[model samples]
Target: MSPRIGYFLSCEEYSPSQLIEQAKLAERAGFEALWISDHFHPWNDAQGNSAYVWGMIGAISQACSLPITTAVTCPILRQHPAIVAQAAATAKVLTNGRFTLGIGTGEALNEHVLGQRWPNTDVRLSMLGEAVDVMRQLWTGESVTHHGDHYTVEDARIYTLPDEPVKVYVSAFGPKALEVAARIGDGLCSTMPEADVVSSFKEKAGPGKPAQVGYKVSYSTDPERALDYAHELWFNEGIPGEAAQVLSSPKHFEQLAPLVTRDAVAGSTVHEADVDKHVAEFAKYADAGYDEVFIADMGPEYEGFFRFYEKDVLPRIRG
Candidate 1:
């Protein structure tokens, strides 16, 4: 089957109104879905924007018909699972069943804001597992009381659930968490174009489940400006392993970013002026078995990127 093309709404860099405008543009440009980042803080101070994701999502529901998914939210930290379940249920009702709750173990950058000690990855994964279970129970439209190792819910129910079950997609970057996603999640959310992860998820989740991947690239008429913009905004993207997960703030991330080599950050993304090159980069993920591929243009201008994509990139890949 041909893969679905989607636009990623970068909430860290755009205001709520801009996000809604981009959502409308993306739908008009023939993208099939929308992925919005749910974050309490921007990765770097230079990015300069962090709108509340839930409020922005409500605006998106009214502005566009495209299906929406949080690129990944952490219900395990900063918010209780019961609250996450309630908010997700309302989103599903508002979007008329077009919402998917994409969740993850979370990063210290966002989760540490509440002044809680950041737990290690293993504990976070355990919390995420229990959280997903709690959410699923509440989505059944029955009052639920859950007391797990990480969280507790007493007499909580989601009255606003849609007729269809709200799909839950789990994001993972490693084997252990991938296993958790397979065991509990309805779909998989990831960033890498690694086929092995997709293969493993499909094998473990059995058949007929979907996996989605989001990738970043910079598109501009000026190749040099594109590369510079990508480096300035996402140099920290090259931070290896779970380092990005543990860093507590954008200042910490900024300090570590300069150590990342240009090639390293450029390797993490496609920073080319050519539309065909951008299209090819996306095809790599689709060929890797991602059911949906969401692309974020790291260039400062969204409208130009959207126009270039609608005129060139979408047709080649969506075909």
Candidate 2:
């Protein structure tokens, strides 16, 4: 069976109004759901904009009927897990239970604003594990008092909540994080089309758990323009390794952006208007066993992007 296809909203690139517009467009374009990025800062200043994701979610809930998930929020830092729990619960109520909280260990790019010491990978993962435990306890509508290794919550309870606990989809990129996702996540969230990742998650999470993956494409009638947008707006995507996870500022990313070549970006993304290529990209994730695949169009060609997908790409994929 074909996996459900959704649209990804890039909060780092678009304003609140634009994000909400894309949410409505995705619904109208026959996309099954929405994945909105949660970031405190853009990877580079060129992609400028980082609205608080909770506020965006509330606004988006009123504007569109499609379900929404934070592409991945870091509840471990920047926001307390208890606060994240309340916000997520309110979001679930606002969306009439269509809101899912997608969480991860997070990056210093967003979490360093508070000037807290950046922990190592093992420590961050441990914090994330504890944070998820704190959130889940609060979601039960009982007063929660948690004093764990990384977080402390005192008699906190979420008053506004949906009938069901907000579903959590954990985002994982490495083996350790994947293990946590399998153990705690109601679903798995990822950006890569890796069959082994999905199979491992399903094996550990057991039957009936869903896995979602998202990626970006730059669509334009002029293929060169598409390539240009991908390179100009998202060269950070080409940055190697843990730089993305450890970089503390957008300037640091901008400084390294020059090292990323257009060809590198081209090799990684579908930066063209070709419907066949677009369909094939989604198929890669579906074939990898993702239950859902989300695509984000980079730059200002989103209107054309939606039209192209709705008319040409989606039907072909569904057929």
Candidate 3:
């Protein structure tokens, strides 16, 4: 298959059943994979929505037939390594061996539950390194016995493991973490979708490791309406905070439709309605040498978005 095309899902959407239906549609639409977000709380005052990620993913497994994994999940702080390993192993089995475990150090908002300490990025990455190490040992059916900077296991073994190794995809933003991904992970995941990032990651990760980037557009027949929703639901992702670290996607506020104001929507997607313009943004990442790009549309114009993507975009770049 050519470099993969995928669909994105937010764990916070209203109708998870609808989300599952969308995944089936994506499979029928020729999408290669599905990436779902992992979140704990929505800060109702801000985004006004948040759904249980693993539960939703379970629904996706039952409702749709597609390869699935979280775009990125924090295994270090939000949950324990053994728990994550067991859950991921089960998911791999449930998905018919089509699951990849994408992980990251994580953001404070999601990790600070139960009053656990939220370390800085460097420390968090260090923790993740050890966490992955622990999970790997457990997944290997080994009676793990180790003491690391952040985690420890005592004769632990996952009773259930997939027949095949569960591909571990790591989310990295900068140089140091990228190097760690190269040395340890099976693949790299990033939101930047910049070619430079992919090349840098591959160099440190060495050859043959998976490198996937995610990008989204507000696809709609009417550019204006899509852009409006982009500002509302998508724009907050652009906000500057610990929350924004995970949501590194950028916005060209000045370049988009000038009329859409800050008050109208949570994001500046008013200009995203133009399918060509929207896909053009995604192409920048593809050109950057990413092996896959997962594009999630913000509004209901999914069919329209898929048509434009398959006809206008895929023909030109997909190999």
Candidate 4:
């Protein structure tokens, strides 16, 4: 089956108003849903914005009817899982159950602001599992007092909750994290178009569990200009491996941004106006068997981006 297409709102690059506007535009353009990044800081200063995601989500719920999911929020640190439970429950109610809580073992870039020691990947994955357990307990609307390895929740109960528990979609890349995700996650969330990963997730997670993937693109009439915009604002996307996860600050990312070349960014992202290229990019996720695919525009040309997808790209993919 062809995957449902959605728009990704880059909170790292767009202001709250811009995100709300994009959400409305995406729905009007025939997009089915929305994915919004949750971040404390932009990857670099060039991207330049990080509004509180929950607050933006509240505003976005009022502005558009499309379902919203945090591309991935880290609940282990910076914010306690108990607090995240309350926030997510409220979001579910605000969206009238059109919300999903997508979570991951977060990055130091966002989690380190509270001065907590950044745990290694294995430890982080363990904490994530416990965090999900904590959140799920609170979502049942019963008072929860969890004294676990990583977290301690005093007598706490979420007063506001939807009719059903908020569905949790886990974001993962490596094997260990994927294992945890399969065990606990209601669905899978990823950015890579790796067929093996999706297949493994389905095999382990069983039927009726959906998987989603998101990718970045730059859209403009002049493809070269689009490449320039992509490199200028999002060159950090080209940074390979664990650097993105361990980097403590936006300045740290900025220092590495110089090493990332235009070709590196161009190679990974579709920075063009060509309909076939955009359709082909979406097809990669569909071929990988993701149930949903989200596309995020890289630069300021988003108005044109929406129009291009509406008139050209979406039809080709759906047709």
Instruction: List the candidate numbers ranked by lDDT, top first.
Output: 4, 2, 1, 3
Task: Give the residue spans of candidate 2 off by over 4 A.
Answer: none
- Predicted structure with the largest lDDT when compared to the true one: 4
- In model 1, which range of ten residues has the least summed lDDT? 264-273
What lDDT is obtained when candidate 2 is compared to the true structure?
0.92
TM-score of each: 0.97, 0.99, 0.86, 0.99
RMSD of each: 1.2, 0.8, 4.7, 0.7
In candidate 2, what residue range of length 10 has the lowest lDDT sum? 152-161
**142-229: candidate 4 lDDT, tens digit per residue:** 9999999999999999999999999999998899999999999999999999999999999999999999999999999998999998
Clashes (candidate 4):
0
Query: Candidate 4 — what's its lDDT?
Result: 0.93
Q: Roughly what TM-score does model 1 have, to 2 decimal places?
A: 0.97
Query: Which RMSD does model 1 reach against the true structure?
Result: 1.2
- Candidate 2 residue 290 Cα shift, in angstroms, is 0.2
The per-model lDDT (C-alpha) reads: 0.88, 0.92, 0.73, 0.93
Pairs clashing within candidate 2: none
User: Model 3: per-residue lDDT, tens digit, 170-234?
Assistant: 99877788888887799998887577778888887788897888876776666567766576555
User: Candidate 4: misplaced stretches above 4 Å?
Assistant: none
Looking at candidate 2, what is the lDDT of residue 70?
92
